[model samples]
Target: MNDRPYHHGDLRRAVLTAALDVIAADGPSGLSLRDLARRAGVSHAAPAHHFKDRTGLLTAIAAEGFGLLAATVNEATDLKDAGVRYVRFAREHPAHFQVMFAPGLLRTDDLELTTARALATDALRTAVAEVRPAEQGDDARLAGVAAWSLAHGFATLLQSHNLDGAVGGRDPEEVFRTLSGLLFRQG
Candidate 1:
């Protein structure tokens, strides 16, 4: 056996990127650290250097997903637009979305995961702040929940092919515009 030390430079990122690709193609259930290391062209134990175990790798993936979602949501021009962006991100990053909300798979206490989740939540809170009317207290919170629910439901429906026949011929952006407009109609 070759005696060269298997020091994979930037192994953490390499493993994570490889893991994302694997999750995208085969779902989270199919992920394996040894497989990830192989894909990264590193030794089987290389991934473990960065991620202690499979759970650590999964937590990192969830963290990355939330970070991307936060950035996308924060870039929206308006609160209503941010809701649309949320749905767009989910549709565009189905693998990430699939991993982000998969309970019992990620370590909830992991610092990276917690930080990323906070950033995403903060982005949503900012969006809510923009649209909340004065004198609306609990109602504002409810509105935020409604916005999230609508976006998540729409994304899930799109992913599951439930809307394929229903949304035929209509541009996705146009559909989002109409749906967001209806949801955010001024009362």
Candidate 2:
């Protein structure tokens, strides 16, 4: 047990950081509010004050993850850039990425989570619109889905080390750029 002070001005942030560390190390299933409180050097019940329960904590993580993802991808200049950024976000925030997509573990109706999800979806749609205009209607939606699937699948594979043989020595972003180029022809 760390000897951190019992009082914290930002207990929520402290608890969230501890939760992320736990998730990254042992996966979400191994997480416990008690463990988070210990990691944060607070009382056993301290985490509950902010998170209420495990689901609430997971919801917060999902919301934060979506917000971060939206900001990351929103900076892209094009669809390919957005895809690459998405993959990078997964790599950089593996704990958040893992929780963000697990609908069963989160409060699907959480206002913050829903709003953040919308922001991320909108960011992806904006990127898709740059290539496939909205005038194409369903085609644009389909393209967005395809792009998201490709990026998400690639990120999952990369994190699982399943791409070691296929990617060889190449950087992931460069490989993603090449892969996206081959799959998506700019019109």
Candidate 3:
């Protein structure tokens, strides 16, 4: 007999939000469906109904992360803006960052994940092109790689606390702007 309160008005969303909170504090490894249920005040089996398994829950999280990234980048004013926003997103959603990029943590082949990732990729590539405008595919592709690597690396380092002193206490966005400008040799 499932004796939990099961008071969630929208169990799926409540569970997902609770999962994000859990992930933020404990990382993905610390998450459990039962714990999520408890946090959501739902029956333990309620989460299972929404997510067949842990992988299913993680897959949904990853998909949402990519969509969030896409929206964040697409709203930026320029390549530098996009880079700054990427870092900001990472900082704001550390749990999503942790689960989204870690391939082994989620079902990468899930259709929802693939579609969301494609959208994020397209948005990122467009921003990268703005970094170094070019007509040739190779140049643009390489520039995109460079831009993505810069932002991803910066964000990853910051998220992991490896860059506490790398930027000398300046805001992360400023540090990224400076590094990106120097790397791309842009004004």
Model number with the top lDDT: 2
User: How would you order the candidates by lDDT, starting with the best?
Assistant: 2, 3, 1
Model 2 pairs whose backbones collide: none
Full ranking by TM-score: 2, 3, 1
Indicate the worst ten consecutive residues by lDDT in candidate 3. Answer: 1-10
lDDT of 1 by residue, 1-187 (tens): 2244677778898888888878878889899988887778777887788889999999888999999999999998787788778888887888889889986998999999999999998898778777785358898888888888888888888877789898887766568768888878644
Q: Where in model 2 is the C-alpha error above 4 Å?
A: 1-6
Residue 43 in model 3: lDDT: 72
Q: Tens-digit lDDT track for model 3 on 1-187? A: 6675656679989889989998998899998998888778777788998888888998999999999999999999888889999999999999999999989988899999999999999999888766666686798889888888999999999988999977776898998898888877543
lDDT of 2 at 128: 92
Model 1 lDDT on a 0 to 1 scale: 0.83
Q: Which ten residues in a row have the lowest lDDT in candidate 2?
A: 1-10
Flag regions of model 1 displaced more than 4 Å: 1-7, 133-135
Candidate RMSDs in Å, in order, are 2.1, 2.0, 1.7
Best by TM-score: 2
Predicted candidate 2 versus true structure: per-residue lDDT over 22-104, tens digit per residue? 89889999999988888777888778888899999999999999999999999999899999999999999999999999999
